[model samples]
Target: MNLTEQVLHVLDNALSLQGRTAGFTRDTPLLGALPELDSMAVLALLTGLENHFGITFSDDDLRGTVFATVGSLSALVEQGLARQDP
Candidate 1:
């Protein structure tokens, strides 16, 4: 799957959305918008992203804005992948 699809997958799986993510678009609000996205869920999503993408996020990279929207989160994943030296 591509980065956006991968990100949507992570959110869907982490939140147990049960394929409801099909309604989500790049503009979908995340942080404050999704009631399922609590602090624990946030951590889970971050860890899931790291595991799925094989990347690490520093404290500096964990800003809330990164999770503001589906697009932003996917961008972070893309950024993490881009930083990989390969």
Candidate 2:
């Protein structure tokens, strides 16, 4: 899967969305928009993304705006992938 699809997969798995993410798009709002995305879920999602991508996130890498939309999160993942490139 591509980065965006991978992100949606990680998010669906992390949040236990039961395939609800099938309709999600890059522009889809998360953070305050998704009822399933509470604080704990955020942690799970972060961990899931980190594990899946084999990239560690520093404190400075996180911000509320990063979770504002699926596109933003996908962009974060893209950056992480770029950082790990040889």
RMSD of each: 1.0, 0.7
Give the per-residue lDDT digits (tens) of candidate 2, residues 1-86: 98899999999999999999999999999999999999999999999999999998888889999999999999888888898999
Q: What tens digits encode model 1's per-residue C-alpha lDDT throughout 2-73?
A: 779889999999988899888989999998988899999999999999999899988887888998999999
Model 2 Cα displacement at 54 (Å)? 0.7
Candidate 2: residue pairs that collide? none
> Each model's TM-score, in the order given?
0.94, 0.96
- Tell me, by TM-score, which candidate is best: 2
Model 1 error, position 69 (Å): 0.5
Relative to the true structure, candidate 2 reaches a TM of 0.96
In model 2, the runs with Cα more than 4 Å from the true position are none
Model 2 lDDT vs. the true structure?
Answer: 0.95
